[model samples]
Target: MTELGFTLKVFRQIGMMKPILPHKMLGAGLQLVKWGPGFPSGVNAAAKRFPRQLAIIDDAGELTWSEFAAQINQLTQALKDRGIEAGDSVALLCRNHRYMLIAMIAIMQAGGRVLLLNTMASRSQLGELAKRENASLVIVDQEFLEVAGDVDQDKVILAWADDDAPAGLPSVAAISADQPTKGHSKPARNGQVVIFTSGTTGLPKGARREEPADLKPLVSFFGAIPYRGNATIVLAAPLFHSWGLINFGFGLSLAPTYVLRRRFEPTRVIKDIEEQKADALVVVPLMMQRMVDADPEVIKKADVSSLKITASSGSALAGELANHYMDTFTDSVYNFYGATETGWVTIASPTDLREAPGTAGVPPFRTTVRILDAEGKEVPRGETGVIHVGNDMPFGGYTDGNTKAFSDGLMSTGDLGHFDENGRLFVSGRDDDMIISGGENVFPRELEDALIDHPDVADVVVTGIDDDKFGQVLAAYVVVKDGKSLTEDDIKTYAKEHVARFAVPGKTMFLDELPRNPTGKVMKRELPEFE
Candidate 1:
């Protein structure tokens, strides 16, 4: 039987068959009855239907669906034997690997919460997170074992490198051999996963699931996407981020083949795509830029025709870069717009990129978006204001009692944008970054985009500086192209020709590079102040 057919059969046996709902009911009316067989049913169906199909590929090895499911069962039994129970939080710290995927499934399947840890995070950060979440168990790869320093070794489960198990640790391979199938397959309560969000304040806030109902719409929406049977998906982003989790869940729900990379390496990424024949990749803006900037000979040598979809998120994709990607691949390059608190709000297709250039496209199936003024009233279509979203998306309020993020049932994204006449979203800049110069609002993104068009400028960040006459003055930090020399007058001249006089940056500072987060988002907070 086909994978879809097998899934439907299992759903029927588990009495999970239900009518699919339209995307319009996503926020207000969608509900998921406990009629379906749940997560295990979908996984088991994939195993039965495509037992030999490759499910996961990493540096260690590739695991077929059957092997993957069997490993999950074994891990679940092992954890259970170790005194773990349902609803316990399992803190996981590891790079992208086959073991991590199996452990995540095993934990959730056993009715435990999976608390993802950022691999790049400091030891203090991880320890604080573990303590804050009250994790019952911790798992770490040998590389990250140092981060767990003095954190109760007894509570940690380390994956053995060789066949020999570490002292007090169960043999992962041996456990799989003992019982290929051992745990009950039941879906946990909705909102079982607690993802922590970075707070504006010092402490990070943990966002828990609201209701099982919220997941139904997402699950259904994912099913409708063009995921092929047992297709390989390249996972390059950090698993701790929301986009990373979304990609992981997408693969899990569809039971697709996945290729895991420990951390993004430009050369390795090119090699893996060709070697694994990966069909899809989920990347951020910086990763894509690096790949594009890699050696042309290496890019030409790599076989990228097998790739069908390239999805980007976490930061904005410049229109020039987007156009170049489409021209190079001749395939769909999707730009997803949303936040950690909110799931996908809108998706910009390659077609949209070609037509509208910078638009974030229409809202996702059931999402409602409104551009609101400071008073929370809707603004005109062409007027820019704060962007508010209302949907079935689940968000845990801030840990520091900052409920002000949400206003009138809509989540405040802290972003400034406006909807075109056709309802396309144009995210101009962050509200905090808006420069109030001489009583006029100047969005840096407009000026930044104009500056980027200059031949000498490789990258540029525009910000507001204190001014005596004006409330705030505009400043530009620019990274010039290698082997190219540019002066402040040249930059100013170029900006004046390309952008409005008020929008032109008043002061320009040349910099070797700008600070960026792991996800490729510019760290505006880290920018140095200039006189």
Candidate 2:
């Protein structure tokens, strides 16, 4: 019997013998096998099981499993014909389109590495990443070709999305039927993707490669969750981001029908969900807020009963927003925690979210989290400290010579959080972003959340300023809604009523707009410093 068959048989036997311990044993075995290395195997298995099921959909077009597989095969052959080989890096700078998905599969099938670049990155940023990754070939969509102007055009394979595939360019469809069939390549034992950090501290650093073993636990975790195989998943976030990339992986592995939106629009998202009968969505907190702020009647009129789960990540989803989503969708909304370096370290199920509003959730299967102090010693439960993740999962270190990110078999996430008595993890904030005022530690998120609840406040950022007496004092930068007028005292009074006295911002500055990155994450470092 084949290894996969034997594994399945053993799994079945264990399932029948020990009903209670089956999940634990299965999770352990999956980790041992480095399940992500078996992605090609899983793809073959899925193709055989659901040959004609719809795989991807966008405004431009849609593709079935068979069509998707054929495209992957053709593209793999085309890339190989051009001298591409296994372990070589291929950078992709494209939007959420069908071609992008096909390219990703083809790259993996050819044993090449994929470097996902944000489509919104400027030419300079793209050049820096391309140089750092040493990308040999760049496959870019026609729209993003300008961003690659600095790079040599001869090294690029421009993919066209229109019906008339560009002439002169290599056609993925013309490759030989027998030309390097898909699913025949060896599984990548090392990392398959090199994701860049969000650059919250400084310029972005490339995180470690993500290995196949890292994905096994995710599969097991999702299996236990309430996701269905045929569920329609709407992708509102940019596909280049980790959330988007992981969702794509999930859809491919689980045989789900995926719907893609070029960009996020609150009204359009609600309309698309209803029109497409989408059953699930993955979004950041900002998107959720925009959706909530849109016409309430649109949400009421939209039929979202098909939605079984909605996942929020990238930033903490406030308790109020979580509750609002649960009430609006009438389904469970989950909060996930992890970085580009780690695929999925923790996840809060709908049940957990409803119970503990702002908790990031408990660690996923086969994953252990340690709250450690500066010296790397484990802190007592309920004491906030840096969060560390340890598992047999695949994780590549930074491309730069920064090995300090990992120590003692644990990858430091640089996040501060504490586990409650119930074992739920609540992220306080980034340790570096923490403010000390009068010798007391303060987290910016706590105050920002409170300030956002104020009616007059459209947006706010709380930062620490040098203080003569207190060592550091809190400052608030506000972006008030149109026609809304408020003074610093009014803002302080509102915040004081909601949060602790120390958490209130001592100074307030009104700004027309706050600087934000493409993904809507505030650029705190760019805020003007106050004396």
Candidate 3:
């Protein structure tokens, strides 16, 4: 078939599949085309449609669509007052609240790049990141002022300060109070958003992305996850991460009511879902685990049936955990598998999880997932290989000039995974995290999964430790369930029953919890050095 013929056929299939799509999706595309692609353009369109409807609910309270748009404009004007210009980098170091949300949109509206900074980063890490990114302005939450010591004093703005200001630094509220309610002039080019990798193995790197012209990817994403336009959403994931930011972007265009909190406290989160009657909850796997482990009565009281979808990403979801969440929430969980570099590769829908338990669902429309061996040849089904992906979201490459290896125009996801006969993907582990012990390639994830299956185990992380006899040996850090006890031998026995003897952890250590980054990835570097 001709290329044009194939493209037409693809669109025909999409129209047939999603005949009743939300009208706002079409409006979103038109708005982008008319006003040029940027966060401000989407917000302006939403304001026009739902002027009086609630757009955001955070710790600072709620704002209607019109109010939300006005704040964004005021913030943009304030940024202009401070000499922020197009293409300039503005680093945002606030938590999940109105301040961060406003800054993200305002920076783009004021013709500046939005550089999202992790709230969990230490002083040194924040300093290094700011310097590396060449951030022209650093807007920080007041609580994190200590970490902003290295940032240029003249270029600092404080937000979300409950206490009296630290003398000269301007607060976000102060800046937006006196500025114009209308948005600033259109920028020469649309500003981009840059998010940092979780940095499990090393220092974090930035993944930059520009505003998307085509809304087809977003529309296709809704088909996979079933998030309706204008649906109420509770964002539990940190906005600095890709997963949360993606949801926020959808909320902007779809004009959803966002229930935001500064932190992911299990009880409060459940209450918010129940009180807000939120239709969707965005979270990482660890946050879900915490919710599932909360007090039983509290969980029962929470009317989470309001939630139609619980979108999870940022890390692999253990099959056991997925099953538990689905059983609790009546199969409302949707596990999304992807990375910062590659937008979204696949989404494990409720039906897919019910049928296959752990399988990451088939690739969404226009996404391509390939599992290839070291030779760059496709591996047979059910055999693990390096996972590569191609999609509509164009990767802006790393700011440091480092790039993921690519073959045939598909970028490497840096993960090892295999597809089942049904074409559902299962991630095995990171390609670099594979341990060559006694000449056998053993992935830590396999051992971790085995340990997690134990009835007494609540959480587990497996790492390869140095060994004189074997090139390296497996060390397991185990977190037992509450009011439960398990010995090192018991864990070893459980592992022996589940996996090969060599793959069993050679050393076991008990811990109350595993150290994890903000995105819930196990911080392997922070683990204790085994004796």
Candidate 4:
């Protein structure tokens, strides 16, 4: 699509948005750019529009938009008074709560770059990250203070603590106690928001984000999902992740009440959905699976009928998992496929899921997905190749100065995929994960998907191991459902019946559960090596 077409599409989507009144659309947009096209602007605008509306609901308590904005102002003044100025970087290590958001907004308003840290990382990793990122200050939660490393106590600010501020170290409370009315000025440049990669493949890398040149990512999202004005959402996904970050920004315009929890629990989420009458659920695939795996009696009693959308990203939505979620919730599921580097590429609605169980779906308006051969030529539809994507939002680069492979003006997503006859994109597996058994190429997803659908198979992960006879052989690690027993032969026989013989596992091992990261992506590197 041309620039004019994209602008038109954005205008059309804006008109269709429930929360944005047509008369106020231009003013709302101007407000987003008042500070910058990033976070603080949307929040500032929302506060002006709905000052008394419920802005945040967390385990600790509730906060109105007026209160959140006032806190943002006071904290921004405090940070500026504390000598934090333009180009200074602050590392934020806090969970989902009102304080975390307040600190983040104030940091941006104070002209400090934000490096979002992974909550699950070890202390050693956190120390390394802060030093490597050259952070001037570390705003950590009381629980994570030990992980702040050798940073001076004066440079450490506490957040989300129930007790009084620790001696010497400043809490957000103490810092903003004077409630200075200064520091409302925007910086010369919008400080970049840096989020670390999931590090499933290797040590985590920081990916620096560029403020998108256009609003297409937001417009395209609303075009795909039905988000209402003043709705309630349980944001269960971690805010540090790219998926959660993007969704949170997109929602500020709608003035939705965000119901957040520091930790995710299926029972607790179901309870929140009932008590708050939430309209949307933001999660990753693992959280969705947990919802499906909850006790049936608990689900029966909960009043979750208000949930209209279950948006998932940050990992693949397995065919079996999608089916089970739609079956249990009656078609509220939507899967968003994209990379932390590249913004969202495609979205699978309930209709798409019902039509093609495991599809990544087609690209939204003004986006492109193409399959390319090893030689960089576009392959015919239905032929497997590396997936390349182009969209309004392009990845800037890694903070380490490295970048992803680019082909024909699109960034390589590093996954192998092909388009179906119906034009739905199906991601097979990581291109590097393909197995060559006796010269026959196979994708482990095919076998994994087949096993996941089995009645007694709770979960499965398949990988290739070197073999003397076959160049490489498939190894299957499974989690068996409770009260069921199965042998290696039984799994192999089922694999043979469902998939090609060469795809069958050479051995099968059962684990009580699979190792996963906070976002619910399986940790393939942590799977025990099979002999």
lDDT of 2: 0.71
Off by over 4 Å in 4: 1-30, 164-166, 181-183, 200-203
Tell me which residue pairs clash in candidate 2. Answer: 36-212, 208-396, 208-397, 209-396, 214-394
Give every collision pair in model 3.
none
**Most TM-score-accurate candidate:** 4
Candidate 1 local lDDT, 436-494, one digit each (tens): 88888898888877777677777888888988877787899999999999999998888
Please, what are the lDDT tens digits per residue for candidate 3 over residues 1-531? 554554444444333223433664465456566667456777877776677889889998999988998998899988888888889999898889988988889998877889887777777777788888889889999989998987778888987877667887888888899888974667786788999865654457898876777666665576577776677899989999989988888556566889999888999988988898888899999998888888899988777888888999998887478888877765788999988888898899888888887677889877888999898999999999999999877778788887778988898989898999899998878888888889888888878877787878899999888788888878999999989999988988888889887788889999888899888988778787767
Question: On a 0 to 100 scale, what is the lDDT of residue 158 in model 2?
Answer: 65
lDDT of each: 0.70, 0.71, 0.82, 0.83
The Cα error of candidate 2 at residue 518, in Å, is 4.0
By lDDT, the better pick of 1 and 4 is 4
**In candidate 4, what are the lDDT values of residues 1-531, reduced to their tens digit?**
775676455545443344545445565566676775667877877776777889999978898887888888999888888888887889888899888888888888777788888887667777777788888888988888887766766678988776654677788867887796433877766767889865654457998877776566676777677677777989999998988888788888677899999999999999999999998999999898888999899988888889988989988886579879878875788889998887877788989988889999889877888899999999999999999999877577888999999998989999999999999999999999998998999888999989988889888888888999998998999999999988999999899999999999988899999988888878888899875
What's the CA RMSD of model 2 in angstroms? Answer: 5.6
Clashing pairs in 1: 16-36, 191-209
Question: Each prediction's TM-score against the native?
Answer: 0.84, 0.86, 0.92, 0.94
- Give residue 312's lDDT in candidate 4 (0 to 100): 90
Full-model lDDT, candidate 1: 0.70
RMSD of 4: 2.6
Question: C-alpha displacement of 44 in model 4, angstroms?
Answer: 0.5
Candidate 4 colliding pairs: none
lDDT-sorted candidate list, best first: 4, 3, 2, 1
